[model samples]
Target chain A: MSAAAVLAVVVGAAAAKGELTGDPKAGEAIYARCFACHALAYNRTGPKHCGLLGRRAGSVAGFEYSAAMKRANWVWNRQTLDRFLADPLKAVPGTTMGYAGVKDRQERADLIAYIEQAGRSEVCRAR
Target chain B: MSSRIQSPDASLSLASDAPNLETRRSFLGKSGLVLSGAAVALLAGRDVLAKGNRPAGSDVNVLNSALGAELEAIAAYQVGAESGLLQKPVLNLAVTFQGHHKEHADVLTKTIIKLGGQPVSAKEKYTFPVETLKTQSDVLRFAAMLEKGAVSAYLGAVPVFENRDLAKAAASILGDEAMHWAILRNALGDAPVPAAFMS
Candidate 1:
């Protein structure tokens, strides 16, 4: 109705569009759940997840795992991990991983991204 | 635009026997008000972030402690799974517990990294809770206690996590941990929600 009001609206829209998006830092914190069972080392808790981006499941060392997991010859990449984390039982019927997977897609991606970074860290390499 | 307005007025008079310009204008005005409100909200959100008053990080050590506790829980569950003491259902539950702990460890590790620190690696060959758990009932009871401890630990650590998302994540996991405890309680033939504290 008024020129001042229209100008205000235009300015507001511009500001809103410039707002910061998702926080990788926050995503990093959200990734702790994966660290327990999946490690970026040769052997930590459940398996050595180092360089797991394209690796297969049940391939980690020294971990006496369930037969269900050992049978899944699938690779551990972003998309596969996302689906598996979304619903572990649904993704692999007999897999021993009992925990329900992460429900959020963005969170799953963030967790995977964090793991990718962690896998490349010096400590991970040293291990 | 003028022809359109005239056509609408003629149709209104023909259909309702009365033209309602006032009602139509009021409806448009109400919608304008709603749009203005939305615009104001958008502006306010931008101003808040522009003020550079973003949330702060929580106490790092408390998060580390939480990670440590989760590590312990994983060790306990893995041992239980291997001891041949757990039934199929219980063994499945243990595996699930392991995954949950792994998720917790991953999040905590990221938090530590965000704060410019390294996550502590869990020690190999952790001491099991075998001495404390002797029977099937005892294993269930021990799990319930462990879950309860996790819930309380998460609650206590919530205040220390400065990041709102981190705090919410902790709360979310704590709720799930409580659920796991309830499930284990029911499996053991106890009330899902314990009447008294396990401690």
Candidate 2:
């Protein structure tokens, strides 16, 4: 990330938590970091990607879901995902998604916006 | 990413592989998983959160739930594509699969509306473990995990739809999701079909 981009993200994070707004373009760039374990379609190190927003926490197929994930009544959306991403371990105690959650408020907002954008990108419509 | 009109068939059919498609053998490479020990703490025992704890309500409610999953899938695929981490063939595969989800969402949405229930809309946000996603392999593993979940989820769904037709449709989609799971497993060098039946 460039110094300017870093500065923008830091500045963005300075806002009050609940009032944060996302920049999809910035989020899209941040999302490149997510490619290590996820994809929009196929499964990778973790579960698949495209449906991360609309479904329940452990609803995707072909993977072992932790009891915590299966039990949570959480249906992912902006507010819900935002809360979860703010601290995944704190939110879902036994989730197998083994990473410290993204901490930057603006970065989180941007990442979420990019996630929403990813579903409709041309590459995702390849079929 | 633009909202352009599309014919139904366009999103559901298999197009040729992308320009960067690898050979058949090379195609066989993808994902894995690991749980964090801190998540366990050796003696932890409390559950958390409460939004998704919904049971299948009426037939309309059940279908709406399915619709929600389908919409999430559409979003996930496009987002993965934006990442630029996938190989050309993998990206092609993701697109084809994403198209399948769109088909699923379309049917679910129409069915919900026809049944006099408001179809659920896509959620405002979708989150993933971006910190773990530093490589293409990680992307594959994450995808595989989700595909496996989809396979299990549809198994539960197929039996729940009170409408026999809807049950059949869910079953069909379940098969498709299974295929995706198997292929990803194969790519990762694991047994594609690991069991006689879904657990």
Per-candidate RMSD vs. true structure? 28.4, 16.3
Candidate 2, A1-127: lDDT as tens digits: 9999997886576454444778999987666544434567655444665767887878888654667789999999887888887766568865544334667878888988888887677555551
Looking at model 2, give its docking quality level: incorrect
Fnat measured on candidate 2: 0.00
**For candidate 2, lDDT tens digit of each residue in B1-199?**
2231212232322334532333431443332232222122111111111222222234555566566666766666666555678776777877767766776777777655655567777655555555566666776776777677666556655554445555666667778778987887776678988879763
TM-score of 1: 0.43
The ten-residue window of minimal lDDT in model 1 chain B covers B1-10
The 10-residue segment with the lowest total lDDT in model 2 chain A: A29-38
Candidate 1 per-residue C-alpha lDDT over B10-85 given as tens digits, one digit per residue, 9 for 90 to 100: 0111112123434654686787743322233233334434666442322344455566667667666665665578
State the DockQ of every prediction: 0.02, 0.04
Q: What C-alpha root-mean-square deviation, in Å, does candidate 1 show against the real structure?
A: 28.4
For every model shown, the clashing-pair count is 19, 54
